[model samples]
Target: MNVILITACPSGMATTFLGARRLEQAAKRLGWQVSVEMHGELEAVTPVSAEAIAAAELVVVAAERVPEPQRFDGKRLFRAPIHQALPDPDAFLERAAREAATFDAASANAGAPATATPAPQAAGGNGQRRIVAVTACPTGVAHTFMAAEALAQAGKAMGHAIHVETQGSVGAQNALTADDIAAADVVVLACDIEVDDTRFAGKPIYRTSTGAALKQPKQTLETALVDAQVESSGAPQGGSAGAGGGARKSVKERGLYKHLLTGVSFMLPMVVAGGLCIALSFVFGIKAFEQEGTLAAALMQIGGGTAFKLMVPVLAGYIAYSIADRPGIAPGMIGGMLASTLGAGFIGGILAGFLAGYSASAVTRYVKLPASVESLKPILIIPLLASLFTGLVMIYVVGTPVAAILAGLTQFLNNMGSTNAVLLGLLLGAMMCFDMGGPVNKAAYTFGVGLLSTETYMPMAAIMAAGMVPPIAMGIATLLARGKFSQPEREAGKASFVLGLCFITEGAIPFAAKDPLRVIPLAMIGGAVTGALSMWFGIKLMAPHGGLFVLLIPNAVNMALLYLVAIAAGSLVTGVGYALLKRGESELPAVADAGSGAVAREQRTG
Candidate 1:
């Protein structure tokens, strides 16, 4: 028999390839010819050719989501969660062969091309609702696709005609068209990050997180149907388009956090470029750049003089944009530039961004104009008035006090004693591991990044070191106590190790989500240890991001050997702790089941 297997995951880091390998081994044992296609965050690896797909007797998809399902239209298809395949591939394959059904393109409209018409509702009569949704997460990986798949499955089972557009790291797939939006009875946005809802104006919209959608998809759908409200055509109620007209009060706070993160995301590239350039200049001796008309001076000019100068403005501008859309950009950037010139730094820039965004949104909503001149509101009137207001406030009110505060803070950090430094590091480290990549982690990261503007590098070093500990520790724990983790988790640990080396904290999320009680505390202890060590050793990092690879660049990190030791020590602590604490998979079934359910609930609440 000829079999075509497709596998995918959010980041394309681990599960996709692992599932393919297991399925291939199982297929080979059964003496079947198999072709595998793996989809990750970017693109497909060794995608199945049309000829190969045509010749296959069965197409099995083990993924959080199937990328471009239309490619296999009319084929006999079998779908299962990627985890199901990892535990027992032989049994999974047998079920695929026995239960695969002919896939009709029209039945699963979510993955249909833009031009495709809506699928007919399931056998139930007129009670079926037409729903459209978009799912996204901060990393644009795991939760994004999981939520999309869950909603699709739930909608199908409940006799609803639903289509989901996934906004993953690779960009939007199966995007919603004008026709789809117009026809939908309600729209659901399952996102942890801000998304453009301009096109969704006038539609009944509901906002939620990916975790909530994944855990209680049926309930989420019901809630949306009942509580979703029609979005207004004007500026959003609380400076966020995603916060629809009838959104709950808590949404306003969530919107603020998302807007701040949006700014940080835009500012990161500039920080990395500028920091690396400064580091490169230090290679010629710390004072080399002081001598003008040289390569070191030129590098410093590009990195410090230009990129660093623009970072605050870009951050403030994007934050405003996330809150009030395009009109807020000019005011926010202008305010940010003023903050920089006045020495108020990143803190002032953040304040300026919020002020500008809310002012712009308020102006847009309240200002009235004739029909002929209404177009001028977004293009001319809004920018001019908002910029004036934001600029005046920054210069006359906010800037001087903020500058003084920043100066004092910088002085304190520069002269801090070792004990104080270690305490600061420990606090930052614990915060980083508290929620993986959630708001607390981002808050710690944003604090470190902000300090870069003040020429303080120690905190940045501590933050990165602490952040790297979790995934690396998880990987080590799996190795030390292999019997504690399931097959899927062991494979995930291997991927987590690689991701940790790259400083992606989300790598340990799978382990944490499954066993937070044991994993989180152990990881936090390791992070704290690494952070304290980094501070005590007086290690300094010039770059804001990059993991172990930062050590390769000359002068990128000071006290590099000690830095590595700090990271290794932390990983060892967490690894050994978790390995001893974790329960073996062979433990009593009832206990395991209860533990699993509790962990699932915790993940959902979080």
Candidate 2:
């Protein structure tokens, strides 16, 4: 069989490539000729030639939105959402082969391409709702597109007209127009970072995290339908109002963790860029940057002097922005600058952000003005009052104590013995793997990142090392005991390995979701082992991200070979342990076996 596979996602990051790889692997296993075209945030990678498309027996589109569907007119087409192909690509392929229909450009409306235009009402029309959604994450990589796809799939399944705007690393795609927003019955913001919601005024809005939307799309939508509150025209952009005219707090609004995570997310790019530049400066020798008027010195100035200088301010500003929207930014940034000047560091910056955010929010809420003067609240009144309050409090009340604490903490960490270092590594490692990419993982990550501004590198090294273990270990486990996993799991393990190498811990999510009891403990154990070993070896990392890839930059990682060994040691422990303990499909009871009949059938057919 000749198969032309088309895979795409909103971000064209992890999911796009994962789906393409899975399907290609499945096709190869079935002894079929496969040509893959992948669409992502960037240009399509090695698109299938027209000759190949013409000769293909089947066109399988595993995408959020099929681009240029007219190209497949008159061909047999099998279209499924990317989510469907992710976990069970082999089964997905088998189903495609069996159920593919001839594509007619005119009749199918060119694969019903995703557009700002609203989808036609479902047949029988009753209970239909028009939904507009925006999905964003701090990294703007994996979760953003995943949540968008999940919501799109769920909305389709529930007979709702839905349009999703993805705010990712590449910025917003499939953006919602004013008409789209106006037509929507409700707006869903599945974002880990703060998103501007002013455009959604007068519409019912429901907010959720990308994880929730990805895990339980239908339930999220159902909840949104029931609990979504109307955005009051008179209220501030980020604030919300219920039907009864009372303020409604969302997950982002109520949780200090979310606000902190938002800050961390916004701060990450700065850390990575600054850290890498500093690493690069070291390539010219550690003392090279001390000599001015050179590239190395310039790199240092850019990385350490500018980027690092702004890092705390960006973190603080965004944290406040997450809390109180635009009104909180000025005060937050001013407070962060004060924190840096006072030598209070990231901890002080965090305090400043919260204080400014709450102060601004309080002012926005309580300091009502006449209609003629209301325009001045956010710009003039809020910033002036909030900044004054935050700056004064930070300098007078909080600065000295926080600076002392940070200095003590830094001194202790810098002088800690191997035993203490190992203990700290173990704790951070466990936290990194605990929930993969959830709050616990982000907490550990944020801690490590915070230390970077203080020139403390070992904790960051351990955090990353621990984070890389779970996915790589899962990959190793599948290789060690293939029979213990399904075909999809095996395929996913290959991708997981690659993702792990790049330090994407979320690659282990599918494995963990399937068997958390086994996967999570094993991963945590592996992470702890890696973290301990890295610390024991006295490894130091300059960059906060890029996993093993960062090692390519000279001096980015000290003791690189030992770091690899530490990672390998942890991966081996997890892989070997899980392989030994995991149960094979054949070991399942009758009930489980019955439940797996469809997979068995698909395997036989393949």
Q: Model 2, residue 536: what's the lDDT?
A: 91
| Candidate 2 whole-model C-alpha lDDT, 0 to 1 | 0.82
What would the C-alpha RMSD of candidate 2 be, to one decimal place? 14.4
**What shift in Å separates residue 469 of candidate 2 from its native position after superposition?**
0.9
Error of 1 at 230 (Å): 4.1
Q: lDDT tens string, model 1, 1-606? A: 988888876434347656777888898899988877765421224457777787889999998655566888899999988889999999999999999999876667554332232222222335988899999875565568877998999999988999999987778998999999888888899887767776777677788777667655887786577557654545453432223322332233356888887788678778988999998898898889999999999999999899999989988898888777788899999989999999999999999899898888777767777877876877888889889999999999999999999999999888999999999989999888876776678899899999998899999999999999999999998899998788998998998998889898878877775665577778889999999999999999998878999998878898889999999999999999999988777664534233222222222212
Off by over 4 Å in 1: 1-186, 202-204, 210-254, 283-285, 590-606
lDDT score for candidate 1 against the true structure: 0.80
Model 1 clash pairs are none
Q: What are the per-residue Cα lDDT tens digits for candidate 2 across 135-241?
A: 98777777788779979999999989999999987889999999999888878999887777768766767887877676568877865765576645455554232
In order, the Cα lDDT scores of the candidates are 0.80, 0.82
Consecutive 10-residue window with the lowest summed lDDT within model 1 = 114-123
Model 1 deviation from the true structure expressed as Cα RMSD, one decimal place? 14.7
Error of model 1, residue 310, in angstroms: 1.1
| Clash total of candidate 1 | 0
